[model samples]
Target: MHYDVFNGDADGILALLQLRLAEPKETALITGVKRDISLVKQVDVGQATSVTVLDVSMEKNTGALSELLANDIPVFYVDHHRTGDIPESPLLTSLVNTSPDVCTSLLVNDYLKGKHHLWAIAAAYGDNLKKVAARHCVLNGVGSQLSTQLEALGTYVNYNGYGRTTDDLHYHPADLYQKLLAYEHPENLFSNKSSLFYDLESAYEQDMNMAQTAEVLFDNNICKVVCLDDAPWSRRVSGVFGNELANQSPDKAHGVLTRNLDHSYTVSVRAPLNNKQGADEVCIRFPTGGGRAGAAGINALPEEQIETFISVLQNYYD
Candidate 1:
């Protein structure tokens, strides 16, 4: 059995899509909500002959990766996140790059020699590599109108990956992947008025409106913090909202904190878009927090520590 493990977000899903489209394969797909990065541990090595991991941080899955190698199950790992000391094992074929501008799908595209270049652009857009995606579109002679469509499609796919669990999402990542497989070109997915794109666009607009109304907890020249009350929409839109905030205020870091059912918070932190540094460093200081330097998150930040989080952000960016 071949197990395919990936992050549920657009970058991960599209990375796998490019590979499967290039070389059709049968594999048991393993994925969860976007925040669920420890997916490698779920693979039963005893029942797996080979595994392909995508977009998930190597640092988070190092133990499980080591175990898979120990069991002699060959693993192909690819990602664009913090990877601490990749293990030396013949069973492991790893392609890990932490460059802020590159995403896993782009890496896979390079590996596949751009056979699925359009899909790669979509993934780049989804991962918020706007300039990179634009360059690809321009080089391919994709007009601005088509570029907008691709960007919207990518953003919708990425937005669907947020949420506390699959139930909170518009479509489970697996189902979305299968639906997307029907269309070879992403523009085909948006051909109909009643398409998935329309559905996701509507939902995204609604959730983002609600998120925008979140109370500002703190705002300074260097940093801003906003708090959202516990709700399905809040949880679903937190990460995307943080991105929007960062883009809107490129010089200032932004933090979006969504209150969890347990009164703690799920925090999304974006470093200043101009600098794109220290977000992971600040987030890692808290328990259940880890991500790339440009953008990071804290899964369950205590309510009491919210002040400290704000302080850290201000100090770091100051």
Candidate 2:
């Protein structure tokens, strides 16, 4: 059996889409809410012959990856996140780039020699690499109108990946991928009125409005922190809100903290857009935290330590 393990966000989903579209495959898909990065451990190596991992940090899955290699389950890993030390194993085919400007979809685009460049551009847009996606659009002679459409589609798709669980999402990432696989071109998806685009757009608008009015927990020259109440909307919109905040203030880091049912916080941290570093370092300081340099997250940050988190972020960015 072949297993397809990937992050649930647009970048991860589209990365796998490009590959499967290029070469059709029969595989069991493994994924979860966007923050679920330790997916490799879910794969049963005894029942798997090969695995393709995408858009997830290798650092978080090193142990499981090593076990997969030990069991001789060949693994193909591609991502744009912090990867500590890639293991030296013939069973592993790894392609990782921590460049702030590149995303997994773009990496897959290069791997596939740009056979699916349009989808790659959309994924880049969804991942908030707007400039990078625009360059690709211009290079391909894609007009501004179509570029804007792609950006919206990518953003909506990426937004659906947020949430503490699949229930909070309009479509499970696996189901979303299957629905998207039928369309060879992204334009077809936009033209289809029945596509999940409409649903995601509606939900995104409602959630984003709520997030916009969330209370500002902390604000300073170096960092700003916003807190949202414990609700489905908060879980759904926190990641995108963090991205929006970072974009709005390119020089200042932003943290979007959503209250969890247990009173802990689900934190989404974005380093200053102008200087996309230290986010991963700061996040990894917590137990349930890990991500790339530009954007990292902590799944369940203690409420009491919220102040400590702010101090660390302030100190690092200051």
Candidate 3:
């Protein structure tokens, strides 16, 4: 059977959604929390069929991907994250762009020739491509009211993807994908009051409320760092909270750290909204860290390095 591997975040889910909506497929789905990007290895290579991988970094999955190519299994890979060095093989079809302005969903939208751009716009908003999503909305003649709805929907879907594990998430990414598959377009889900949007909106609001009380570890002219204690809510909100902070203070780089059980931390970093670059550079310096220019994260950071993280961010932004 075919395998569909993707990041659980909004960009990955929506990218595959758009592709399947355009060309229906029956495949085994493999995904996990947003930070769980090394997914290509999960595919049952013995099953023997084509594979479609989305959103997750090519660099992290390079080994598994290389094996797939060696097996002569055709693979369609699309993403906007850092891809170290692409392997050479005619069996691989890769559309990897590291541009901060784009996300996997937007790439799929381009591939589909805008057949399902509304979903793409929402995905863009969820991926924090505010300007790009807004431009797409305007181009489609979507008014302010609809644009706001799309943005909220996108953000909520994205928020549901974060968590230390699926137990902390409202819906497993696979379930969430199935729920969204019912809608041919986002507008349908928006009009249906019973859609997952309402549940996610309420949960997102509660999580953000708790995040508001999280202690600020550091603040300065060029950077701000906040740390949340070990809790399910902290794990769920850390990434989105950083996005909100970046929007609130466009000139300051932001970091949100959620203390893990071992006292290590899961970190999310956002470059200044006014200057959407270098976040990946800052995060890549740490172990278990990698992402795009505008946004990046570290899966686990030793507690002792917290000060170093703050200093690196400050020095980079300063």
Candidate 4:
């Protein structure tokens, strides 16, 4: 049996989307809410013929990945995050680039020789690689109007992936991936009136409206922190809201912390747009935290350490 494992976020979903479109395959899809990144171990290697992993950090999944490689499971791994130390095995094919300007889908696009360039652009935008996405369009001769639409598609699809669990999402990531595979091109998704695009777009607007009222925990020239109440909307909008704040400020690092059920916090950190290098560093300092340099997050943070987190963010960015 072939198993396709990926992060639920746009980069992971779209990366796999491009590959499946280019090389049609029948496989079981494994995914969860955006924070659920330790997916490699969840796959039952007993019934697996091959495995494909995308967008998830290898650092966190190293143990499971090593086991799969030891068993000769034949894994194709692709990502744009901190990879601890990739195993050296003939059965393993790794395409990981930790470059701040790229996303997993962009790397997949290169692998496919641009078979799905438009979809790749959307993933780039979703990852908040806005400058790179724009430059990609300019380099490829794509017009401005189409670029804007791709941005919206990326944002909406990306917005759907955030949540405490799949229950909070408008569409499960697997369902959303299946829904999107129907469209040969990203633009076709926009043309269809009854597409998931419209639903996601509407939902994005609603959650973002709620995020506007988040309480500012701290703000300075180096970094800023905003707190959201314990609600579904808070869980659904925390990461994307961080992206929005990063884009708006560009000069200051941003953190969006949503209260969790245990009085802990779910945190999303975006390094300054002008200097996207410290997010992963800052987040990895906390337990249950890991991500790429441009944007990283803590799945759960203690309420007591909230102040410490803020101090770390400022210190890292300063």
What lDDT would each prediction earn against the true structure?
0.90, 0.92, 0.92, 0.91
Per-residue error (Å), model 4, residue 43: 1.2
TM-score of each: 0.98, 0.98, 0.99, 0.99
| Model 3 lDDT, residue 287, Cα | 80
RMSD of 2: 1.0
> What TM-score, to 2 decimals, does candidate 2 have?
0.98
Q: Against the correct fold, how does model 4 do in TM-score?
A: 0.99
Model 2: per-residue Cα lDDT at residue 276: 88
Q: Candidate 3 residues 187-274, lDDT tens each?
A: 8888888878988999999999999998999998899999998888888888889999999999999999998888899999999989
Candidate 4 C-alpha lDDT tens digits along 64-183: 999998888999999989998888999999998998988999999999999899999999999989999998999888899999999999898888899888999888999999988988
lDDT score at residue 48, model 4, on the 0-100 scale: 89
- Candidate 1 RMSD to the real structure: 1.0
Candidate 1 pairs with clashing backbones = none
Q: Which model, 2 or 4, shows the larger TM-score?
A: 4
CA RMSD of all predictions: 1.0, 1.0, 0.8, 0.8
